[model samples]
Target: MTLGEILAVAAVGISALTLWDSHQERVRTEEKAVATADRADAEAAVLVLRATPSRDGDRLTLAPLNPEQAIQAQTILFPSALKLPPVETTGDPRIEADWFAEPLKRARKGAGQKDEDPGDQRLPIIVVTHYLAGGARHTSRAIHDLGYTLEGRFLRGSAVTLRGMSIVRTVKEEGAQAALDAVWTGRHRSAG
Candidate 1:
């Protein structure tokens, strides 16, 4: 073939390659944007709940931190070391004395005498909440710390209270049932 013809073909080939590369880059950018949006949506649907101790300090009242994202369903799983069964509820559930009294007693008894820090007496539990936002159901898993301190004038008793609650890393789940199953089976690992 003539030199001019060969040069023309080479230019055309280079132009085609440039167009293909641009198309691939656009596709990648679009995909990334969609993934980011999905992640944001998942986070927005997560419910942050707070635990309040009753007057007697034996029962706990659980409620959502945000009133708008009311809890549709809830489940709480104690640490494997506690060997406690999972608690489930469809409404604002009041945790009776039985649900946590024994555990607190055992934990206080188990506390080492050498340790003087009250923080050492805290217990960790996993809380999974399902809520509806924008007509879609979302599930979130969080870790809450239950704090206990020695109280009383002369009897020297311990009072169980909620220290704080924080959402675990990658808290978003595919669905409510799947998240509950993962937590129950110890498959869900919290980042904090």
Candidate 2:
């Protein structure tokens, strides 16, 4: 073939190579995004502590602080396998409570202790999983609500790609009185 024909063939070959590279890059980007999303679905749990200050009885709720609008998944309440220490209602500010005991609970279930003795009295753990607006089964926050308040740190995820925040601490709950008081009076809490 002539030099011109050779140059034309070279140009076509280069264009084809470039297109293939572009396609590979696109595929890699898509894979990265999917992996990131999967990681996000298994995102860390949030710890929330809520209480109602009232004369009747101060009801406290411990749970994961997820989006308020997020829908709740089927909550599974598995009794603690190992004996979790009772809530120490004491003078000291910090009380000892099990922080995120889901894994422990699962391990216990895996073992045949509970199968042998089902009647055993174990403190039930309320595990509530919340789904984000995207409808992905995001996180399963296990709150072992005792008198002790959770203490830890949660680092928020990046702002560019909004995902679940990593809850370093361990809780969520709503006050019954607060809801009722708002519904009835539509005003502030009555000062005692």
Candidate 3:
């Protein structure tokens, strides 16, 4: 080929190389983004567990000793269904299954203890907290969107029981914990 033709061919080859490199970089960037999202999901879950209360009335807030139930509750409480993203951060996702489940379940057991009279039996309530994953901005947004206007900076989930009546708290973690604690402590007893 002539000198001019060779030069033209070389330019085209160089341009192709540049485009390929750019494409590869884009792919790497996308993958990194996806991995980051997954990490955020896991971290958010852990933070919530850490913030959860250790005791709920008569319930010691024991860990969910049942492996199956603990796993299920972790799924239910963390990575919460709320529209908000994680406020805290984590490298790997881990759940405090036993810590979160045991106490609330224990409180339930305590409430069930046969007492003096039918009217005297009191139910128990349990509250759970989750520290947000991701940055403060993300955590704030998640908390606000989730509707947790509490003093602590975390995600909250709760379940309460009164005799056979049961209620699950989705948005108000602190209030739920307080209410649950009151029942467990006998501060609030139902009139039979």
Candidate 4:
């Protein structure tokens, strides 16, 4: 073949190879992007699942604090759980009221124990869970009404890529109020 014709054929082959390489690279990039999106969706699903009630019949209760001593204390009664431990406040202050003993008290009183006045043993605890990447300023500010003092926090995760933060606060009277307000206001950051 003529030299010019040969050179032209070689150029055409190189062009074809280049096009094939570009197509393969594009396919790879697309696959990577899809995989990343799928992973993100999965991470969100996991967060939602974590927020669901993992313990059924797990009663949640709160103890009434001394309104005078407790800042922002109100007459509103709070619920508590029987099987759970005393109020645990690490990140912020919290109150523990004996919710599990009411039924027992009634039963005992019915059995003729009138002196069984369930003592007001309430310790305040404020728990905040942050899913995904978010700042803690709002939560910190909201719990202020609940009398919570930021004590400590830690991250919880089932995998390395995704995790949630568990903020435990110790609530005094005002801190408890703020925490209750947060709950009432639905201030917790949602995935949506």
Top lDDT hit: 1
Candidate 2 C-alpha lDDT tens digits along 1-192: 999999999999999999999999999999999999876554532324233222321233323344442434424332333333323222211211233243333433455323233222222234444544345445444433232111222473111111111222223345422332232222112210
Q: What shift in Å separates residue 142 of candidate 1 from its native position after superposition?
A: 1.6
Estimate the overall C-alpha local distance difference test score of candidate 3: 0.35
Error of 3 at 166 (Å): 16
Candidate 1 per-residue lDDT, tens place, 76-192, comes to: 776553456889978775455558655645543553232234453445566777887656777767665555443443565544443334444333444533443344334323311
Our tally of clashes for model 1 stands at 0
lDDT of 4 by residue, 48-128 (tens): 111111132122222212221212121222222112333333332323223323432333334443332243212222343
lDDT score, candidate 4, position 59: 29
Query: What value does the lDDT take at residue 137 in candidate 4?
Result: 16
TM-score of each: 0.54, 0.40, 0.31, 0.32
Q: Assess candidate 4 and give its lDDT.
A: 0.34
What residue runs in model 2 are displaced by over 4 Å at the alpha carbon? 44-57, 68-133, 137-145, 148-192
Segments of candidate 3 deviating more than 4 angstroms: 1-4, 45-124, 128-132, 137-192
Each model's C-alpha lDDT?
A: 0.61, 0.37, 0.35, 0.34
Candidate 4 differs from the real structure by a C-alpha RMSD in angstroms, to one decimal, of 17.2
Question: Whole-model lDDT for model 1 versus the true structure?
Answer: 0.61
- Predictions ranked by lDDT, top down? 1, 2, 3, 4
Clashes of 4: 37
Give the local distance difference test score of model 2.
0.37
* TM-score, model 3 to reference: 0.31
